[model samples]
Target: MRKSKLMVFIISVVVMSLLMVWDMPKVFDNINLGLDLQGGFEIVYEVSPLDGKSEIPEMSAVSKSISKRIDVLGVNEPSIMIEGENRIRVQLAGVQDQDQARRILSSTANMSFRDVNDNLLMDATVIKEGGATLAFQNGIPVVSLKIADQDKFYEVTKELATRGEGKNLIVTWLDFEEGVDSYAKEMEKVAKGEEPAYVSAASVREGINGDAVISGNFTDESARELADLINSGSLPVKMNELYSNVVSAELGEGAYEKTMIAGIIGYIAVVIFMIAMYRLPGVISAFMLFIYLWAVLKVYNLMGGVFTLPGIAALVMGAGMTVDANVITFERIKDELYKGRSVKKAFEEGSQMAFSSIFDSQFTTLIAALVMYWLGTGSVKGFATMLMITIVGTLLITVQVVKFLLGLLVSSGWLDNKKTWFGVSAKHLPDVAKGEERKYFGKFHNVDFMAIFKKVSLLPVAILVIAVAMGVFNSVSGNGFLNLGIDFASGTKITVQSDAPLTVDAIEDKFEEFGYQVSRVQLSGDNNEMASVSIKEVIETEDMYELKEALEAEYGYEPSDSVVTPVVGRELVRNALMACAVAWVAMLAYISFRFKFDYAISCIITLMHDVLLILAIYAIFRIEVESTLVAVVLSIIGYSINSSIVTFDRVREILDGKENAKNPKEYYKTVVNEALRNTGERSLITTITTALPLIALIFLGSPSITGFNTSMLVGILAGAFSSLFLAAPIWYTFRVNKKPTQKKQKNVKKLDEPTEINVPGINS
Candidate 1:
């Protein structure tokens, strides 16, 4: 502990902070943004098996083919994903010509050639893929096509040339359907417009092969257009629209700006609270907090991770976690200082004590993050990936780097007797025997949490039962398990644009008059100039335009609609359920390995309770359950585990350290109660710190994100409650008080009384 090391640590932190700010703009510019954050459209298309074909086209090949076609739109950084077996999801960001993009994407573009007698000849198969090139033929703009098989083309041309009875011609059709093949008829359904799909029919005086030119009064621009279309090739399989969404640039830009402001405000609020609560140590944490954000973003950029709205929220929330880690260490040090220990000695002991708690909390959350990455999709997947990366950054930055800096200051001996620096007032110090003194934040040390739980346990249990009943009734009533949002039910969502204010009632009335059952109506925009109307029943493409026009004519509102087919909706529901189950099991298994089966089961039960409570609230309130609900549920799992891990960590640490141990039945309650009390401050502060960022999201984020934030807020509260009152008490009951019938079912011998076993993580 020397002054030289302290100076070095201070210099390193300052320089890193300065460099981070200096390079932040460059990192921001390089960062990738998801369609939701960057204003674009995403579509999930199901590639149905072509007529007469028993099997569907290869999904990977289909994705690649679609990717090549999408590249023609010239949208930067388009993403193409193959989902399951027959679906391909395409996302194009910052695309303005949505109509053109849609048309080009779904078009069959199945080109063919025929003779004057309407006799079938060679089609695109005879032409090499991507072989079309613009050319000048006879001083006119023309499209050149290279033959894939010279012999087949020569034979066709020879046949045309021999038909010299004033009939020596070949015809070209962009979307040719002779109606012979049923698959061709299917293509007929997808290819039709005001502009003819035909390019030209030319007379052949002599037989030719290899390469030929087609000119049909096409200008230079039209020639290039034809060349590009031909080069992009044709769809290998018919793409059925499963789901599609279009977001305006204005909406995305506004969300980005507002979310940024909210994050900054939340960050400042947390920093101020930290400083006020812990004084100098809080200042040290704030400096490291700056570096935490900077380092996470820098790594995120390097990893080519896309930043979405939820992803941004994860970063802000991660800052809170970083602060929580710092606080845990700082609080322990303050406790030591109150016991009359020197600042240097306190730092040494406190840091070691805090390590186990920090490790358990971070790793449990990391399990959730990893599960999400493996199971989640689209922007949800992005959020999971970002969370995983941030967890690592938090551990390295706060757990390691912050510790190093704080230790350097302690080593320098500059903080020898500065008890006040850690928020320990002279009056707060205990007068007990030296080293035996203890200080508590509040005088609830003897409050029997278990006794209170015995009384209030009925609240959560009753609410849960009611929630399950409501879900059953709702499902049986045909609405769904919950009032599923359009995201979960495949249907059309029409985005109506108007400057005039409108009521949801009036909109619903209009839709009802049109024989449409309105599921829900959402208003957005700065002045509520947009109404997104959801229709549960699937509507035909032909009727979509008619409906849009009718609504516009009646209300002077221009409506653009996006559709999600029931197929994608079903898949989403399945995956969401699986993700929740897998995440919970993963956390349980991890805890079992780290601690014991008793703690694992208890933690899992608490986590499940928190999610059930969230679901119950959503159902009772008739809130829309969608993909974001999945995010909220999984996040609660993480938070719930985090709290339990911290508490259990302390429990294990204390029990292991006890040299004079008694029978488990004799001291179980005393030990368990002590563990919970020790970690009570950390659990409470961590929730508050993390919840602050989520509160910002609820108030300042985009309207689209309101449901997500509400779920998150509820989750934080539920996690805090369950971890404090439910987890340990429940575990104690499981370990110490199993009835005879329960023992028979569990296949364990009945015990005279529950006693602590010498398990690996249990006082081993």
Candidate 2:
């Protein structure tokens, strides 16, 4: 049986290895990269009625129209999303003709027929779907349209026929600019020796209405384009560009390469740390960690998901979480070995004992990820997706596979006397045969946590208060509490890259020469050859094109630009708040259902403390707060809850032995203090593992995500502090002060009988 177990372990490892080698490369190649990765353009349009008083068209119809236009552009997998009630966001990745794409996207295509008096006679409502086709008439290319309403066309022709021969001209106009284009205006322009705005004009002879031909001074290409545009259907409402982001392919490639390097560095550091700390079990964990990462990316590829910059960050964060679960189980196994259990028995009991905490942590984090996915949009949704995939992957691969491999190794009877292999020393072991009690195993085991909680608790509160005061003062002084990024502040950010080194003053001078004021300039890239300049004003489309041309002339290549309007900025703020609030409420409900109300309260308070501390740091340090801050806060909420739940689980376990003790309040203190002591190392280790990727990202990753990584690093440190010092103490305050009910007393007495405590584990 032992041989079979060993063989099965070997086979599993071999299978995982084979699968990774065969499909991992394919997964990387097939995964769709978002606009932020590949070079492309994204724009948000505010939809409004053509006339001032008409009701806005349905969002579905508008998106369908936009989708049709994108089809003409030949863009692969364009993303069109409706934001709020009146905005549509279109993302086209890897589009080459960005200028033409933007022009085609915003074109109204509102074809019209008017008489010499500039009176409207017919409109695009007569054209059938896909009815327009390019054709030849008398060796001249023209657009042919199958009119949906033949009777209306006949009436219009009959009315025009009543006018005099030379004056009875039916003028056809394409994209009739409201308040701008008219027959009189065109005639005036014609008289001034300029081109007319109308496409074509025809004299009405009879009321023939089966089909209509729009003949113009057209080449084959122009005629084909006009036919395609007509077939695509005119947008029911006018669209105003409110936000846009255009990235250069070179910048995207640089970002992807740098971020991947950072992630690899972080992953390696985490693996080395785990092996150094846990010995053999750490080796198994590191192996499973590789499998875990493969499974996540492979699954993402299978799902046909788009990979983005934030998605990469999510993957790095998942590595941290994967290591965290392993550390918890390994720590538990070491604790079991210290109690004089055999290697096999310690492996079994530790796996069982660690199950509840790991499950609780995973479950709570799942809640936060789900909330983020439900309420998030754009790249935020992408981050949430990667996070969810990692969580699911950890449960299926990290938790189960690691435990199985380690179980097989221990049960083979080859390491029966090798407890040191599991990282337990002879000096720390207690002999069960001699009736020596097992002392706590952590370095902090001898420290009195409750004795210092009173003082340490004050420090966070004081810091939070000062942070709030600073926020108020900053707000009152006309600057926002936190340094808002372009994502939240609604501005234009231009990224200019040069082969030679560039400075802020040089970039500022260039902008000044262009007659535009620069708000701020940040330098990045290895040699500081790239500069990101922010402008408070949203540059118009024509002006942006001119600026891009000028910068390209000055620099070597055209730069990337992102512009956001005030409307989208406001919407982002609202959605971010909603995402955070929904996450907190959802977590509170989940914890309350799994544990108790008081425990739920304590966990939530600690989570709030973590967020406040992170915000405080950002506000005090003037870190630019962007839309990704929502992601950071939500992620920290998940991380902090994991720690809080683990500690609470320990408190519950220790309290199981307190049924017969007098002075229950003092016992509560001991239970809480002991819980902190027991879980302190796990908390610290989790933070370190999680922070590894973030620190690497801050120093070595893409500048696009540097602020995001920095914010996450601060939140992680704050989460660890709250988990160890604040969470359980708050719970202790609630528990020690509450009076026990008769029913609760009965339950406690029922648990008094010595029976097997069924620890929820894989074996169970």
Candidate 3:
């Protein structure tokens, strides 16, 4: 209450100036562009070679080979990696034409050469069928072959020998750059009757098995083609494309525009509502809120945080929460004024009283955001990032920025005691009659502290037990953790827009026939204008074309484009884990610096609980552990922390009031109860506001978005519970010690009077 106006103004200016200097344009440029925003093609390829006969090692080898081939294609920032057991995802950025991409990608490069008149030469089948002999002569492995037409074979062999002079025939083991290469000189020396060479035509191996190995000047591409040809061979297992579509970057840009516009409009509306409802205090609060928004954007820009559609939505949601602290403070001030307290006394008491509520509410939100960042990936992570930033930004703006501004305004007599802003006047308000404060149930009872501690600890212990039990059951049941989405696990994703409605099951069945492990299929696009099918493995370009054709034939609608793929696998998982860990640690550091160590510890503990609980549920329910899960977990962390912080702020206030006190048990208890009681309504309101949009998203969003929503819904609810039950109780246990005193006895007596405890319209 005794804050310096000059100091407050200087701090605000300094913070604002710093934020402005940190690339304001870049910050407001819109959310970070996703793959969808940047034009690209994503394709999922199934790496199983002919039926299910391939071994894990063989499949792994094939995956490596295919990845090398895609890398050779030189797509910008291309992502080509394995996913799950036998899946490969390839993402090509800035690919405008799907047909060209498909053509390049689908052309099975089975590079093989034949005689001039099309006579049968060495092929991949020779090794598999006839078991060609390999012998070491002169310390060199000699691969010998026998052909049906010896004369024609000799001519081809001689040509190869002659061409071998200075060049080496590089037989890429599987066409990779690291494959084996043999010098043509060695073959020439043996063919020309010089002496036994590294490779001899002595017919040491026999049988016309349908092919022969050719080695020579094969550049990287040619080598790869040959390897692919040999590895794939000619097979009857043809691929049929299930669906494909071209996603226009224009759509993403449009979405970005609409989201920005909606956010601005919504923010403006909230500001207007606050000003009209609270008058001068509302105006000040609104200004502080604006500052909060600016700080969030600045921080986001400074940190290079990417904004997405969901991120934009989160920003809008955060805007609502940003003013919550101010509202609590203003309401308390009004209550004090109604009790006939002097303007200065009302302002002081109200701000002090509001701390608990504000901190609690914000802490809950912070916790939820943290959990989301931990468990989410991709766009969901983006949302979580924004939510977390906004919560922290709000704390700074509301607690420091707004509180200081309000103090300055009151001190400067800008808001006098006489003038009426909303309704009640300073003179007309009721006098503060002395009364007994209400006593909570069992507050004065001489209960055993140790017994209570044991009883309370049981809840967290039970949760831990349940979590462990579920984890064990999940491991034994063979229903591994959530089946991650493509954003995390990687695979093939195809979105098809049609004029008519289509069933997900029908499309899934069609894809299954094409030998695709169709994991998920759902209606996408506004008004069900499109259907998206995601599979466990990527589809080759040729297979994509085939699938598109099949769709056209069966569904009477041709796909507008070939499928696009994104890389998924170990690399993605590793990166996601690293990013989430970094975010969590960074959040902890920031919170520790902003608040006390105990508060930071409490926040982290609550966050961990929320995250673990979410994971436990996911493991229990067998939800797919995709990138969206990360988003949910991070969101939970942010929300839970927001609630905890509110309570801590109240504790700080109580500590400030009784600096000389030996024990702070009474202070902590009052703070906790007051914080929870005051902020309960706002907490419910904020939750509802956030929940409504998510509920809509669950019903209307794309499969990916719906998954994100589901995770968020669970996280939000868990975060709310953790804030009230877990965070506060834990904080009380850590900070307060039960001790009997005469002051406590006096307080208990004061609490027994009904007239002292009840505030009119409070329960109402």
User: Each model's TM-score?
Assistant: 0.87, 0.87, 0.55
How badly does each model clash, as a count of residue pairs? 3, 0, 78
How does model 2 fare in lDDT?
0.82
Per-model CA lDDT versus the true structure: 0.77, 0.82, 0.57
Candidate 1, residue 96: lDDT: 50
Q: Any residue pairs clashing in model 2, and if so which?
A: none
Range of the 10 consecutive residues with the lowest summed lDDT in candidate 3: 170-179
Residue 382 of model 3, lDDT score? 70
RMSD values, in order shown: 6.9, 6.9, 15.4
- C-alpha positional error of residue 116 in candidate 1 after TM-score superposition, expressed in Å: 5.4
* Decreasing TM-score order of the candidates: 2, 1, 3
Winning model by TM-score: 2
Candidate 2 lDDT by residue in tens digits, 74-143:
8887889887789899989887455677778998888889888778888888888888898999899999
Q: Model 3, 398-497: lDDT tens per residue?
A: 6777777667767765456543563344455544455423222222234333334446656656766776787777667764444455555436666665
Error of 3 at 128 (Å): 46
Better of 1 and 2 by lDDT: 2
Q: Which stretches of candidate 3 lie over 4 Å from their true place?
A: 1-32, 36-306, 313-321, 328-339, 344-429, 432-478, 487-490, 512-517, 537-545, 552-601, 616-623, 655-671, 678-682, 685-704, 735-764
lDDT for 293 (candidate 3): 75
